[model samples]
Target: MDGLNRLPGFEILPPEAPMPMPAQDLSAAPRQVRRGTSSPPLMWLRRLLVIGGALLLTGVATAEMSLVLGLSRWSATGVVLTAIFALLSIWIALAFTSAVAGLPGLLRRSDPLRLGEQSPLPQTRTALLMPVYNEDVGQWSARLSAIRASLRAAGVVDGVDIFVLSDSTDAACRQMESDAVLALRARDGARVFYRHRSRNTGRKAGNIEEWVRRFGGSYAQFLILDADSLMEGRTILALIGGMERHADVGLIQTLPLLQGGRTLLARMQQFAGQVYGPLIAQGLAWWSGAEGNYWGHNAMIRTRAFAEAAGLPRLPGRKPFGGEILSHDFVEAALMRRAGWAIHMAPLLPGSYEQGPPSLPDLAVRDRRWCQGNLQHSAVIGAAGLHPMSRLHMLVGIAAYLSAPLWLGFLVLGLAVSFQAHFLRPEYFPATHALFPTWPIVDSERAIWVFGGTFLVLLAPKILALVAVALSTRRAFGGRMRLMVSGLVEILLSSLLSPVTMLTQARQCVDVLLGRDGGWTAQRREGEEIRLRDAFRIARGHLFLGLALTALAVAINPLLAAWMAPVLVGLVAAPWLIAWTASEEAGDRFRRWGLFLVPTEEAPSGVLLTSDTPGAGDDRAALVAAAMAG
Candidate 1:
């Protein structure tokens, strides 16, 4: 059998109309082509009025609902708020626990660079493997070339080999990939390489195995990057150094701080990530130490160790939910740890980057796969006999995925309590009932269970990340108002958006269990226009549920119902909300409204940190020169 057919968990893509793959000369894929000019202001204003109006309406509801809880001493009000509070508290505890423990441990990493270290360990050759099924190869190479430049800059060019392992059967992508490799070769030559299998077997994991089985013996270390992934040259060197420093270490994963995402949702996400990523990272590092989780990107591993632990068992079930592990990185980490090797995470080093989905629907589609992947692990954790840290990672993954469902149910239960206390259970209503109703969403009993719990665990980590970044780089972010406002807006939008995401994922899990299949699609770049239909589809269900809940909530107070109406309304219009969030026009509006922005050259160094300065020629030219001339 061809290598591709041998892998158990794979989906065959449909054939495209015949066209010659881009020739090798076409390899230098357009790294960044300016698509089209900005949408006109009149057009922009039209779109913003819609989403902004929706958000403002929702915000009013949220405020009223929260305010109601503060005034009334109704017995049931206390009960609902208290429940929400309790849930929030637990979330807080988990967040604080993780941040305090996890973040530091990641940064204080002490893995010594073996090459530069002791005598017993000889200089080991390493291969950096980037496996692409169907993606922009030139775009992919441009990123890797940056890393190669970084490695060369560190003067360790000879020690590292990069292979672009492609499973793209399409003639176009194949040629595009070939062209990129040639372009890279023109710059970096043999040190940077490319390969493609006639057929792909078991998705991503299977692709890696194909290489490991063949050239596994040649390299002492191997690194993995997602097609869209990148890391600062410094981060790569630091990772190698850390691995060498710690003899027992097998892998070091850098948290991928995503970039280049447009659309309202994407911008909101980017803002949240930039603001809150650090604290959570710090917390995770402090707790996990050498036993951190692997997120499948910007990570390094011992080639020998991975090969020894190689054979991943095909899952027991059929189709989507079962077969190969969708979330293979975690299991890989677990296997490494199980094999007596330390698996770890490094902080957001400069140039470590990933792309966010262009639109909301696209992101949901992606999450569907992730939800299934994480859910499948439910059976793997205990059965595989993983280490304690690995199990925690698995459980947390499950919890984070499942939190939406739990919160949804919790919200329903809370509103039910509000209805019961304010309208139905007159006995529990205080004398003030004649003068003032329990306001809205003021169910103390359920509020704690819902909002409180979420804030503690889910939201707290982001806050922590934000605080750390702000404290360290106060001047860059301006005063606290911007940060605080940015955080609040991000949190509010995310909360509204998440219900839609959870529902999508939940359905995906169900689909997998039912034996339907899904495939990996290339992530749409930022600034892509989102379709109205796609947006509406994603948000429709959430809006319906949100409205229902809000209406029921209003049984106690019309003002509360009126207040929450926008958020509930957004839920029902989830698909549209998602689409709009992904819209470039929406993204521009967010920017105009002072929503968010990322550095063009966010990398610490010139290339990764900032794209070529206005007049400077592309750095890739230098790499091309080095590869061809050398």
Candidate 2:
């Protein structure tokens, strides 16, 4: 189809070059990924340290908890609660140790690929595949234009093919996309193609696979991007160079930082990602080494390797956990590893970017789909010939969602035991006619200590992130004072949001388990002002929950209520918090005060800045109307 074909029936895709993608079997063994002899010992040591530290921490916490509850007088309920605490503590301990393990790498600023400022252009041809659904065409097209401009500036535009692979079902959206593509081609005078599928089978995974089948043979590597993703020209080159240098590597995933946040929640997310994201990613990369998992976007992959190893088979069964894999990235990495291909993460590489959900309600909407996808990993975790690390990756993905409900259970069970202790008659008189009936009580001081320690365990990583930033990257975050203030604001906001997120995720888990499918829904990238009625409607359940917990705790004892204040407050203020944080004005107010300041906000990249800037002869009203129509 030509660029002038503005009709709804036409598409602008390239010529076909079919590549076979055979379905992989989960039960059978495939060739294992071969690595250098030096890697195993280091990999084993890192794994051992993380695993061993978690075990050690859990064991010590269990003993302390046991002591606090008085093991000699332990009720069945107390024992069960203690076991649950131990399970919860393991996740915390693992994170804490991983942060510690990764701190050195961040401080040193290690670059594994050695992609310096004057890096030479990559020799291999690459395809930049952006698969869109019902997205705002104006914003999407602008970002694409910015990317093409950045690439052209870097003198690598000749080696790259930009393809807009659309699964957009809306006719208006399709027409707008076609028009936008034509505009981009006319304006940039660059090679850009567009393809639209009438049937979005398998959703995004299917969109990509269709591209691979039709046009995969022409490109040596393909960089997969989401609708919201943008990368600097240099970062794109660095990724291509990294792939070229490592022939055995199947994929190299960049650390895509959050950008373009305008709401309070979005800025908070931006801050957390800016401050804490690197430490977490560094730790993951250190241990994961060549076995890193894909996040599905902003990552480049070898066309042949992906075609040979990452083709997905529909999980046999019904919905939710069955049929098409909702989270295809992790499974694809596993399948690639099973076929002897390495997957690596370049955590230190910068300039890769994406947008975050602008409100808590929007986040919940997005997370429901993720929760379903991660839960589906339970079926793929046992697949044969997968690397142990790959399996661990899937297990971690499953636990990430499951942990929320587990935490809720812990809270409820603890509350239940508290109720039983306060309401039930003491059984101390049965043993002997004691002068004073033994009270059903724990060591209050020890219990306080245990609680304090658990809180510290939960908060330490954030504190460590602050310390790391202060010592190294403070200037990037608008100097030390700004960084510290931003860190504090982030911690405060995150604490308030945690209970609400926990409850939301717990509900999502229940929905997924109960055979509810979180069908593929388009993400709302640019947020609107959240109305009070809308916020309250979404958060009424959380509000009711908060009130219920508050009354129950107060009835038990004021100190118990005080102990649960943070969580109770979060629940009670859910609606107001949602509405307030969804305000762009509130986010702007914080930005003025230099609170929640991220590097991207202080000094934006050229491509990112260009995305927001209007081009010459542009019709602003028309673009806004088109975007609103989507």
Candidate 3:
């Protein structure tokens, strides 16, 4: 039972030592964490006083300006719109902040994640769902192989049912599914199975429904997995244990660290998520508690609860607002919560991991489908029977896609305001106010606040995430040096790719609104890159927006033009960023900067390798062999 016990659905690996790390000095792994006492009551009191005072001053000043400037006539409308904006902003801030704050609590409560634990799953059985469409079989197999090996090492490899739910309309993918299932087997009669439906009807949700309808009776719980995800067996066990401990919970979702991404863009995303994701996730989990929703993957759900709560509802018609819910996860989560079942997210499930999209275009293609789904959910927000938080989720889902249009509106409004102030001014010009008055940019002097606030919103999360990673894990991922260089590179790449990405996302939002689709596409393999030509073609999405911004900046001031150059250059070179981002060669070259997930052989000096389990470090060797043989 200690060394190699069976876990449901996982094949066993023979005992062999873990792969050895190159011998090197290892003094830096953090042995202690700073669990400082909560802020002094007086300190909090002072902060509250300062914050409240500022709010009071802001409200009074706004009133004074409106009254003296005779702008009070617009106050009623402004107040309503301002309240909406404030509420939306607060929701976002809470979702992210709560996710971050829950970490210390998580760190305090759970055992440090390690390898090799027996599942002791009791009598409960679990179904492992790997929902696949046109995804790369090799990539999916590799992740599952690692997960299975981890489970095998922990002992409890026999209590799980693994289903490869193929929604492949393509004949080749169907064959690929058959081949993959056949290749992954134990002496047990095909513990791994594949089923494809002729109707690939409602996309992912429909795919899941088919499984539930046919196989729901077999397992008490099911863990849904994205094709490109991996979870440590220990994490899986912890989730099952957590679920068993909490009877009213319908689902528990884990945020996986992004893995196997080769592009600079992908690494940045992965690093950002790893560094700050926990805090944001923790913050969300703390506030959300039992209202968290399923993300459709890397999550476990109670079968009966889901069946009762999340039956796919038909939309009124076809196209953007109809048929199946593209974003079924949030809606499903809301449904579970509305049904009075707790929907939770495990903020400390470290073994869980996923892959990031390698190229901008690829990500845009995926998001287009998501946009349609979310927009559709916008309507579901009004369903009278839904829980408040569930309705909030649908609202947020709609807002996320709509942000592009909002940003675009801000740009247009800024331009109109500028022209009015410069060419058609009619009073109202001390050239300074904290908030804009819908008039044209008064002398263009308020640029700093606008630029500064925008900058903070975009970059503060990265900084916060970085701080969280350093505070919590410190030397866990080797040393400060190993983590530092990796973080820096991730940030730089992310800044460069973001503008281009936003443009692509903007197009996707537009496309979804227009009722057109990019169609169902397959995910790429672990290391594949978009061709340079494709990258360039894709860059065209942002070029116009970028060039227009540049022209506007120049028209305003040469200084402004200079400041905005990166955005323009980025748009013009969108294809280059996409190509470089999607390229493994580029990723490998950057990895030398001590900035990312180095290939296994080229890991930097002084990296500390730990035994996954308490008893031994042998399972990794077995894992390598089994993975290769397959």
Candidate 4:
């Protein structure tokens, strides 16, 4: 018996046990040098073109509004509001234009190069690494078994190794994990291995780094998987092949689609990902080229490259914004890229799957952690030798969280300006030595046009995604009518949820700014019903904010109230909306009506089927079942 066998949950094979030989060294493997198509200047040119166009549109709109306000007086508040609007406009325009750029790629017959097939069965070993903390042992066992079965089916089981690197501290969970590993070994034999760490020093990144330092030398490549992640065997093989082919490519990230959703919130997110995720990903891939980002999991990395370049440096600051980078994936990608290794996004790749957070609360919790991590990137954005695109990725990530506060500020300023216009009297030609009295007037018609134009730009990506789906074979989402109806439902739900999310994100940003750390917490995977009282308690602030805003708007003017209606409505309905969306019953009911139906849900893939069914006569099934019972 080995030291590992002495652990409460561990079972190790005998020292004399025969194992499959590792793959040959590919360090001197001959490969053609392939440079990225989009150079930094060209990529920047494309970015600037879209941003400039947005600025032009915003400038025109702002000019029109200024003229309206200038008719009465040029208020400082007007200028400030225009600046905020410009920032928001530019942010959304970038997304809309990216979708526009991506539409053609999505419609193209051939997939992106990153997603394309490469040489089959490379003579190099790859490790499928799953880093888990306190997670459901049964689910983990089922997923691991399915992945092994998948590889076996693809005849690539011999080319890969599976590792469950546990950072779990709970004794019972560790024991359950150990038992599951033992059963899996009994059933599947030596290809799978398990190790539990007593101290999770650096958390997930630390867990992986420890593995790399210990066994990374044995593998040429490693595939990182989240606890909820699932990849088809063929997909894994393709990634390995790609790495073997592109020696300079350090990391390749696949767009993981959401599956196995059981709540209205989850289903809605699934539908969005299935329909809209591709467009956004396509656009990002198009622009990102070789400077793409890693999404933590459903990604492959060159073992040597990662080990050499991605040794994360501790930041020179206190908690929250500093210390070990919370969002390690992005920083790792940037570091790898900084070392001259290309990183790419494979959006067109299939068989990559990840489950969404089951409910609104679950999603918020995850977002909070991400918010902290992304904000931490602000410190790294200025690091030396980083590719400009890499910095942009970091900046964009930071902005994704920071935009919430900017939006809140914009709304508050707009309301303040509206109140000032309605309540305060205008000065007539006293301040300036002008003959004509400066009367403050708003060009209502022009303002309407500007508002409509902004809305159109904001909504264009969704419309484009819908059109792309419509143009394709409609069978996937149950034909054109259902697809269209589903799109509308998604839009409605997203719109209702936007205000609530905005406030939630705003709160998170404030918390981070206040030096509060979003400690690493395992996300809730399974859906649970939320009581009305619980929902109310969680969303009480939103309700109060809504009521207060509506009251103030009404007191200011009916027009103001009407303009603020959407925000007020969403905030006011937050409790019921959260409760309803969090309910699995509501999701199932909607599923019966064919609402929020995705193709994967309609016809699950073999990999998904295997993962979903853990008790199918395999020897490990009993172990998994017992673990679940425990």
RMSD of each: 13.6, 4.6, 11.5, 6.3
Clashing pairs counted in every model: 81, 0, 28, 3
Candidate 4 yields a Cα-based lDDT of 0.79
Q: Write the per-residue lDDT of candidate 1 for residues 17-71, one digit (tens) a residue.
A: 1211111111121222222221112533432443344344344434434554665
Provide the global lDDT of candidate 3 against the true structure: 0.60
lDDT of each: 0.61, 0.84, 0.60, 0.79
The TM-scores, one per candidate, come to 0.76, 0.93, 0.77, 0.90
Model 3 TM? 0.77
As a whole number from 0 to 100, the lDDT of residue 368 in candidate 2 is 95
Ranking by lDDT: 2, 4, 1, 3
Over 4 Å off, model 4: 1-8, 11-73, 109-114, 425-440, 615-630
In model 3, what lDDT does residue 578 have? 77
State the lDDT of candidate 2 residue by residue for 1-630, as single tens digits: 242223333466666678987778898977665643212237888888977887898899888888877853367777887888888888888898888888898898866656544667879889999999999887878888899989978888688989998999898778777667766766756677788988999899999999998889889999999989999998899888877877888998888899999999998998999889999898888888878889999999999999998989999888899999999999999999888888888888988999999999899999999999999999899898888999989998898999999889988877777666667754422344432223356665577677789889888888988899899854878789988888887888888899999999999999999999989989999878988889899999999999998988777765567768889999999999999999999999998997888888788889989888634236645543442243
- Model 2 RMSD in Å is 4.6
Better lDDT candidate (2, 3)? 2
Worst 10 residues of 3 by lDDT: 604-613
Off by over 4 Å in 1: 1-92, 102-122, 416-458, 478-481, 513-515, 559-569, 573-576, 592-595, 599-604, 609-630
Best by lDDT: 2
Report model 1's TM-score to 2 decimal places: 0.76
